[model samples]
Target chain A: MKTHLQNGQVIDDSVPQGDNEAVAGKVVSGSVIHIQNLRKEYASVAGVVPVLHGLNMEVMPGEFVAIMGASGSGKSTLMNILGCLDIATSGSYFLKGRDVTALDRDSLAHLRNDLIGFVFQGFNLLPRASLLDNVALPLVYSKVSREERVVRASDMLSKVGLAKYRDSRPNQISGGQQQRVAIARALVNRPKLLLADEPTGNLDSHTSHEIMNLFKELNERDGITIVLITHEVEVAAYAHRLVRLADGHIVYDGSSHIPQGDNEGTMSKNSTESSAAAHSTS
Target chain B: MISAMLNEAWNSMWANRLRTILTMLGMVIGVSAVIVMQAVGQGAQQQVRESIESMGSNLLMVLSGSSTSGGGVRFGAGGIPTLTIGDAESIGELPLIAGAAPTVNETAQVIYGARNWSTQITGTAPSYFTVRNWDIAEGAPFTDSDLRSVTRVSILGKTVVDNLFGDENPVGKTIRIKNSPYIVLGVLSAKGQSLMGRDQDDVILIPITTAQRKLASSQVVGSVRFIMVQVRSAEVMSKAEQSIVDLLRQRHRIREGANNDFTVSNLTAMANTAAETTAVMSLMLGIIASISLLVGGIGIMNIMLVSVTERTREIGIRMAIGARGRDIMLQFLLEAIIISIFGCLIGVILGIGGALAANGVTGIRVEITLSSILLAFTVAAAVGVFFGWYPARQAARLRPIDALRFQ
Candidate 1:
């Protein structure tokens, strides 16, 4: 039996009754998010075509998962729903034991503020403002006092190695430097879940690897949940687990054995979905 | 929030310093015109009042004709022929009238030494100084004895003294009036020019008996030019005028309700007319100046709209960062108002300079009233508020996602 939480996500309240219980049940916890039978579709002149089809996923309290898919494989669609940027058409989504699928846009925004931090591919910085101002923007919306917001934003920028550029405009910096500032801005509000969609898309491969390393350090040290979306298999390899989607369905979900510290190699030749499944069982 | 808004406004203004300065030019010129025009108008009114006061209130000038050569009826010609030495004597009997004098004037040439000067000669009784509000600055005026004896004695005005005597004293000296010798009794005080630009102190005054006996042609005491009446106080002048007009009209056998050949204008009426004309002119100038203020406001609006377009991406980023629409609106609106208010402040300084320039160019006393300055500033602020609102609203209503994608 599934019970609906106030956030509109369904909680699977049934306790396991041995091996048979692991078959179809998706367990949702008191401090985590769970998704089951999640579907999203777009109604175009070509009729209703599904973007996400009967997908199932779970996020633990401190799990760092990366999603890998091609451009049209529905990875971003799933990330948007997970980050509360959009709502799923038919799904049971649970966040911290509360159902969140039925909440309105305002409530969803509230939840995103309280629970999610998003880093976009474009590093959406206000071009004319200082880096400190960009980092303090979210806190400004949350009604933080001016003095406190400045102090916090400065500290966050310094931690992200952007302290020297705190007063500089976005146009005065390189792409990697801008992305570092974006990362500092994302962390300023200290949200529980960091949803980064192609967070290093505009950076060089070396900068991308450095950014992934920073993400890994943040996840391990702060125990914050991290969900990264990327088409590059090498970028995804930095995560502890991988969810591969194809034709709007998760073709594989398992522990990924990436080259332990190979920052320069693409992990695409590591194995196929079938081989990964065989390796997981062995 | 207010600090952020101000920063936004101030920075935006400096973003295009040349455009902002150019826009302020319209307001500066407009405000200056209004202030200068008002000051000059006020100065003109004051000059008229001073001229009237200098002419004195006691003198009543009467002409025989009802109209000037220009075809407009002269104001005080109604009781002219009937107002003679007899009416003057009668008016002297009134309680409010302290004295009355009959006058006769003629234009003639007076030869002294080898120089010939064309002068206006006035004949009047010995009491002319008292009734006409004139004073002697040198020697003495013609006395009662001179009037009784029909003495050929005269008092010279400043212009006559300057021409006939130069630096020498003219008192007790002999001068020719129409080929007849007359003793110069005194030199009158210098009264400046009148509103018509004519010299008020140009003519010479002689005893009425001398003017009648020496300069008269072939007729009886034809007509006294005017009866100059003097009263105890300015407060009683109106009463004195009414009494004289009533006595003269009755003596001339004029009916009631007819347009009297003569008119009476008091100092108060003349002053009031001058003031009214000045007020009307200032009001018209103020309206014209207000048009420039409107144009300044339009300039602000146009610039603000352009600013909104240029900052769309910034606005989107702010919205994405959790700023509400109202917050964005306030930021832009505040900027526009700040720019306009700054313009107004500078315009006020320019307005003061304009008023001073007008005063220097034309010797007019322009008084800038506090209310006028305040009104101008209030209109400026209102222009800022009114025109700045639309562009601010446009910035605030932009969708976050669309704004960020504007590229």
Candidate 2:
């Protein structure tokens, strides 16, 4: 029998017994990410404009969650905070059960290198580096030996089906191939969590589905936790769970199996409402 | 990790080969200029030091003072023949004076076989050789007995030997000076030049008694142009000079407050002044060349700044992949160091080549020292690090989010 807390509220309570032991300062929950009352603000010429207003979320290990939101929903900010690329204004955030808010800049960088991987929509590969070198980039920051880095990077490249093009530059490959290389680089470090921001935003429908299938396969086969951000219903449908944001607040958190027509109509209306809210605040 | 960053820097530099070379050009020119200028200036100083050494150490020249004639025409020092052989002999007996030689010189025509050349003839005792640190190359020098007997025997300078005797040994041969025949005694080992750029090995030596009797009959008895004095050591040079001046004044019976009839000049002090002047000149040359190195360092900073700005997106990508701020800084800094070191290497080669060429073309002395090469290398590296740091810091300070959003 255990007790659980969610969003500062006791959500689960088993039968109270005198023999039950208290965990005492240990987070017993097996969550990959835990955020409580996270807030972020930006100072503009007008005044302090608040972005995220006390958001709370939790992601369990091996969970495949898709975050969906319009442009002004603060979803990008949340993703940055999760990736350790940005910090929250207030409240505590934990990754892999370590307090991220207390870590310095360099420590955060090391955490990102050790525990998380990021994939961007731009397919940001070093223009002059070969695919093999690009995949080996994260291991360089980890102080891995040269021979081992080459071996692991080549192995990851082959897993992405880019073994034949290991020496090819990014410009020499197609957009789909480039995205695959980026994915290979992100996974070369074997991070516990993968954060992808619109991994298919620049791809066509067929390529988008191909990338999403690769993600799904990695999650199911390796039990790798994934937190991706997207607006398309089809992309979200590939994930096991979905989280939606509107006006800096969570609008939905449920299974990804929402009806297609209904989900599309709600997405459009939420986008419009968020845009209006953005105008009024500015 | 450092090797990986180095490899990345190499690739980026290779990708922009033209720009890299252009940026390196400034360093090349600056380093080479510094090397060449230092070589030239040091060469000049060395030449001056060598000439000063040839003039001998702890030496003094006592010149006869000016004399006013009836028409108020004043003759310069060394014109009145006030110093004499007796004065030189007395000065030689002083406690601090090592030796003194009375010398009289005049240009005269000399003939050996059919070859005749006009050359300077110096008449002095054999002790002049000891005072001047001169050595005889062949045969034997004239002795005190020869001076007493007033024998017309001469020691020939190398230049006089070359001109009058050609390849033949002039020893035990007769040479005519002003129609008076004199036997050749020996030849002098060559001393290249004096501090005044006068050829040292272009004069002939004879006994002072012989010059007074046979060459110039109009001069007063026992009188010579000047007296050459050598002190026992450098420490007592001033004391010796003061003693000599007082002794000469007492010997001449000069009245109180009256000017002496001779001037004693410390040749060593004059030589030191010349050496100091050249040292200052060398330092000035080095400083002027260092200004170019400063400009070259500025050029490196300018190019590094432009490179950082141009590669903002690439920096963002590296940061996203888990590169720390220091990692980014080191990468750019390494690139700058590589450029400067390579440039310095090429510049060293070119500078040595240029210095050799200048020496060959102009026949001027040029010295290239190991220390100078090391100095140029160290300074170039320091310049690279100093100039590269700011641009690297600017790149490091960039936020990953902002850099990623940059176009």
Candidate 3:
């Protein structure tokens, strides 16, 4: 698909769905937002320095993208803006293809709650609450009925393969299991965007891979859009595409070299491997 | 959301268990102090009331000789001389007067078979028993005939009986009193101890006529020393006292400006005084006890502040997870209240137990008034809210990004 930028310059890309339809020179194809000329500045004793400098971004519906960066690369600031935890100092940001840069605090909070599911690096599970209760927390905040919340929370837990451990405290579970619980908690309200900030940063290599695999599974199986921030290349490999940021702007956006064995590919690969095993036995 | 906030608070409190407990300690002491002090105070008051009741509530004590200038009889040092047997006779004539008894008292050391008891000896009218609410546990009082004939006979108090007769009944036996043999007439009933720590039943009672004729031998009984009178009912006591005071004042010819020599004390007034005094004491005690509750509240405040600091990271996490400032604030605040209420519950149990134990040891009555318990619980809950607010606010105001970023 070819779309013209604001400068009437032609840009070519494959449109995934109707979410990428053009609107005032900005792509809007079921994509809720198009970030253009986004900028963030921090004032210290030294003076104002920008953290996000004219950053261009697009979030399409049902697309899992990872933003990877080295330390102090302003990925966190970008994630904050995306999650509405903080507002960008100056930006042309459209949410659901509608401008949300002018929204008030209450509106922003409502938007964050309605659309965003944040999974932190530390899991951020309330240590004293049972897994089901933790998962049911967002529904509680939204004033969902007790019975409905319980049913939904249980379903979410079962989806994460933690149905049996629903009554256990977060501390009683393994680190990977806790992250899975956090994922369940985040997804309970069925938020439109899963915003995970270095979700596997605190885990070991094997657990980190397991978490990444689970994220990939959730993105593929449930079709939930995920925007993950990470420093690790291995962690970013599970996503369909990786966007690398340096300083305050995107330096790279492409598929990583590593092939993530998704469900359909795994099934086909498994069939081939099993045939090879059968032939060898014969 | 409220419940989630509560859960957040509970978790934080549980995480810092020691600090939380220390915080609750101030409240515990404050609650216990208020409760226990009031209890002890009530108990002591009850004890005094009971003692006064046992002393006969409507009885009036009348002493002779006024301290006025123009009295014919000089009552030895600063004494009242208005009261006399003739005045007792007039008081007895009143319909409201139930009984009247004239008395002459002397402290004596009596010896019997190698045992000695130092006690008061009283020469009294036959109506003394009725007037003083005294019953003869064994034997009888001297009759009117015994009094008219000047017969030497005596009845002993319990202490005197125990000292002189042991377990044996000494009625109809002859006992020596002041080198004169007087027949044992009766033993007075047990009246416990007096307010001044004197044994109430330690005295000996004899016929007033016989005491005057046989021992002191003067028609003028020194200064009309003592009289114990009882009214027909407690309601008529004030009227009876006023009437007697009026009669004595007229007979003594005291001027209006002069301080009356004789002091007439009704047991009812004495009882009221005692009760009032005890109530004041209990109030002081209650105030002191409340100090512990204050201390416990401070403890809770201290722990809550520490908790606010300790859970800064967790608070940040919740704020990031779509929690508002109010949510975080309420969570910690709820935790603070819960701890105080817990301490209050425990302290109430301890206070009641302590008060009951004190009552047991002191033989005093303790009434755990509902108001006291309710007041304690309210104060404790208030302490929680008051002390917890600052910390909760601090937690709520914490920026989510900042908190999560806290190492």
What is the RMSD, in Å, between candidate 2 and the native fold over all Cα?
4.5
Fraction of native A-B contacts kept, per candidate: 0.17, 0.63, 0.30
Q: What is the TM-score of chain B alone in each candidate?
A: 0.73, 0.95, 0.76
Comparison by DockQ, 1 against 2, better one: 2
i-RMS, each model, one decimal: 2.9, 0.9, 2.1
lDDT of candidate 2 over A1-282, digit per residue (tens): 222212112111122322212432355367788776678898899999887776667788888999887788888999998998888999778898899999887888888888998889989999999999999999999999999999999999999999999999999999889999999999999999999999999999999999999999999999989999997768987888777666666655656654333464354344343233333433
Q: Cα deviation of B197 in candidate 2 (Å)? A: 1.7
Please tell me which predicted candidate would have the highest DockQ against the true structure: 2
- Model 1, B71-136: lDDT tens per residue? 344444533454566666787788887787877878888877777788888888867887656789
Candidate with the greatest TM-score versus the true structure? 2
True lDDT of residue B334, candidate 3: 87
Determine the backbone clash count of candidate 1.
Answer: 11
Tens digits of per-residue lDDT for model 3, B19-95: 77776777777787778887777767766776676576588878764544564656742254446667677777877
TM-score of each: 0.70, 0.92, 0.73
**Model 1 alpha-carbon drift over 4 Å, by segment:** A1-118, A136-150, A192-197, A225-231, A237-282, B41-63, B67-82, B85-246, B254-274, B361-365
Q: Model 2: runs farther than 4 Å from truth?
A: A1-29, A259-282, B67-73, B217-221
In CAPRI terms, model 1 is classed as acceptable
